[model samples]
Target: MGRHDFFSKYAPRPGRLRFAVSRVAVLALVIIVLGWIAISILIAPPPSNEPLATVPLESVPTSSQSAKGSASPSGPRVTVHVVGAVKKPGVYELPEGSRITDAVKSAGGLAEDAHPELVNLAAKLIDGQQIILPGDSTQSQNPNLPAPSNNAKISINTADAQTLQELPGIGPALAERIIDFRTENGPFSSVEELDAVSGIGPAMLEKLADLVVP
Candidate 1:
């Protein structure tokens, strides 16, 4: 082969060079578009949920409300008539587990003439129980009072507030004051010390002197 013919056969033409350059340009453009899409997916911000995440705070209960919620219900009650030598003789309604003494207390405790020894105070009381005092059921000169008897005197130092009310002209208020005085000043040494209690006049003291003992 001649030198010029060999050179023409081996070297590329302008048309083929133009076609290869066009293909390379199209491939580079596709690569750049794919790289941009990948970068956008990796670095884009997360979806917002501001309204969904927000919530209102709940209100807390107060101490009084909590106490009401935790409280247990009450039990059944009973009614009884306390007639006789009580301070306030009448009918009263009380809860279950009440005793005869409790019914007596509801009627303002026993009166001056009430004989505590005659009734069983520790006994349980039922509905509609009639609590008649020692001498109350009978007809007499002082039927509402205690039955007369030659009995031992009441002990002043050991007597409770209700027992103290048995003294002549003594009521619940005076009995409580006497108990308070006794607690503050110690036990009474003599009957004359009755005068030391508030609301106790000389006449009252003289009346109590013969009734109580230390």
Candidate 2:
């Protein structure tokens, strides 16, 4: 067979050729769009099941709170009654471990007529204690009186502060306390009544048992 004849018989029609080429172009476009969508879905991250992270809240300390933390600690306190010769004699509150000197100062110190030498200022103070200062009246009246003899039994009711000081363990301060106690509560009925006096305890009473009389 001739070449031209073979070509003519095998070649497709123009209308059919155009239709086939359009169909192939449309199919290629659809495939390209579908491939792009699939690639985007695979490359993207998976959806998270956990909740979103939240910001934390911060607080600043207040002025009062800071002051409370920085303040110094305080110790226990004692209450006492001060009377006679001080500028302001009344009940007062003082810190624990305070001494007789501190109590006197708290009461505005000694008066002009106060005999400061008649008390033991260095003695430690106790709660609910009463301090009595010997005024000019008590001192001037018995300034020249002599202390009783060591072997004699002093009368607690009638003896002055100087005589009371002769007892064992009795200082000027304690002597004044004895005088004030008897003056306010009346003459003691028994030697045991000495226990009621401030600063006089069982030990002091025992020491004075043989040396003093009610």
lDDT per residue for candidate 2 within 120-142, as digits (tens), equals 56655656666665566534554
Model 2 C-alpha RMSD vs. true structure (Å) is 12.2
Clashing pairs in 1: 113-146
TM-score of 1: 0.37
Each model's TM-score, in the order given?
A: 0.37, 0.40
Q: What is the lDDT of candidate 1?
A: 0.73
**Model 1 residue-pair collision total:** 1
For lDDT, the strongest prediction is 2
Taken over the whole model, the C-alpha lDDT of each candidate is 0.73, 0.75
lDDT of 1 at 102: 92
